[model samples]
Target: MNSLALKGNPGDGERMAIMSGRHQAFGLWGLLLLIVMAHGCAPGGSTEVGPRAPVPPVSAVGLAPDEPLRVVATTSIVADVVRNVGGDAIALTQLMPLGADPHAFESTPQDAGVISDAHVVFINGVGLEVFMDRLLASAGGNTPVVTVSDGIRLLAFAGEHADDEALADEDHGEDDPHVWFDPNNVKVWVANIESALSELDPDRATTYRENAQAYLAELDALDGWIREAVTVIPEDRRGLVIDHSVFTYFAHAYGFEQVGTITTGGSTLSQPSAREMAALQEAIVDHGVRAIFVSTTVNPRMAEQLARDTGIQVVPIYTGSLSDASGPAGTYLAFMRYDVGRIVEALR
Candidate 1:
């Protein structure tokens, strides 16, 4: 697809220039595999998924004779986080395949088996999961379920004229589900993950503790690094006007305020009305916003048009899922880093 470059302010070119150095998605995935290796063994014991995986949807999970704990996570992001804590003792099934969108993912029969047989299910709850209710009902499991983001302090989508209870849209909620975007908020998720995984597999409590501790230290460093990086933007310039409410968590965690979103509600599936678009356009001019951060999971054409109409630059970033383990936003940590780098570089 040929991209029509939208020109904005002159200095904006420098930011877009650096963004142009984007890694090829496949190549970045190769580098991502290496990074995961340093973090120690991935969860679910083995990397070798069977030649023909016979994952059933939700059914009655019977006893496994000396089998590992069966755990299922909703997305690769949740899977990666659980893998860190579960380490080698858990058999985890990720419902959504790599590079899939969590917001609008449809559950399948195999997914039923994953949820059915799992001793526990983990989800990034905060209304982030649109398929949770149906997936749970489909799974038909008796497993104790846990929401990793349940206990974390949450921020409301800070759009003045935005509705907080817009449930009609599927992909997003009034609350931002991208808490994992902020490493600190993820630390809260880790605490919940460690507790849930440990309760299921007490024998490996030490491993979970060790993994969680190490991961937390990295998160601590991540928080520090984000602050340092964000400082690149002058204090007064730290405001955001985004394609959707996707960056609400990131902006809140960092020091930026989300002045407005293109979509009137939390969901990306909802299109912006002409009236809403007009309002957003005005906000862009008022805020002196340099660029609009758009999610690659959804279509960026709307944002592109907004950029063209206003001469405000639009920069693409990974929000919902990591790039295929070979791209810039492959891992959770790297995904946040990549996004933050792009946001800071452009806004600063």
Candidate 2:
């Protein structure tokens, strides 16, 4: 009966304390079966998927009038977006704690309880929540799960090494899941969130649309700011090497080349082997990469070691999670601004 407690900000109208219980073996088996089934039905079943039509807005016939719509978001970033759109109209709960890694987050019984009582569960949903299947099964509910990344075109893993071909293919043979690296993709997320929330609670439809529009304008300004900020770095110096492959979308949008990563594939859970490490170090030296960008959610030991070996600097950036309430990256907008400033400074 292991217990996990996550503290929320009282000022933000968030739950102050959440208690989650460990899952039993039966639930684990059910989760595994669900994953297997999803994998079997996936297009190409470990290969790239072609472009598809944009995800249609979700519509609801009616809403419960007893109280606000009970909404659950899997990650803080997702929760923040929902908060912006839903405002004071919805009862939203974020599942993951501050700075928790979504890729490796294991759900407890309390998390299940929260999910079971929710009207809708929102997730980043490009394989970002690796434990989501188990969490949903443990919760045992028919709550609609909404994926915020539904409409964006996904990027595949880049620069695969010969030694890591199998691992890369097995782990990330499909599109990369870190779409939020580009602010434009987040615009898509906002649209999805606004539509979902409006549908669930139709009475607040006007408010949701208004809030979403305001946020979209902010996102537009953010995209412009990133472009201007990136112009400080020279074209040749715009090479990025990070802890993991998290910047594909960012690089694509900003005209930077992804030199390499400390860990292979998209997920931080995958480890870099000796040969892979050696290869990355060599590439860094060859490309004259100035610094290695690491995520706050992941351990910096390996990145630090690589920096020591190559005589480069190690800069920590927020990746999978946001910072604590008082930190620099407490919000998604702040997170991107801080990270981009760090990246431009390091590269320039």
In terms of TM-score, the best-performing candidate is 2
Model 2 alpha-carbon miss at residue 196, Å? 0.9
Best by lDDT: 2
Q: Write candidate 1's Cα lDDT for 131-246 as tens digits.
A: 55556666663555677776667665555343323322432223555678778788987888887666666766788899999989988988898888898898778778776677
Separate clash counts for every candidate: 11, 2
Candidate 2 lDDT: 0.73
Task: Report the C-alpha lDDT of model 2 over 84-135, residue by residue, as the tens digit.
Answer: 8988888999999988877657778899999889878888877677666666
Off by over 4 Å in 1: 1-66, 160-174
The list of candidate 2 runs beyond 4 A from truth reads 1-66, 159-173
The residue pairs that clash in candidate 2, if any, are: 21-109, 21-110
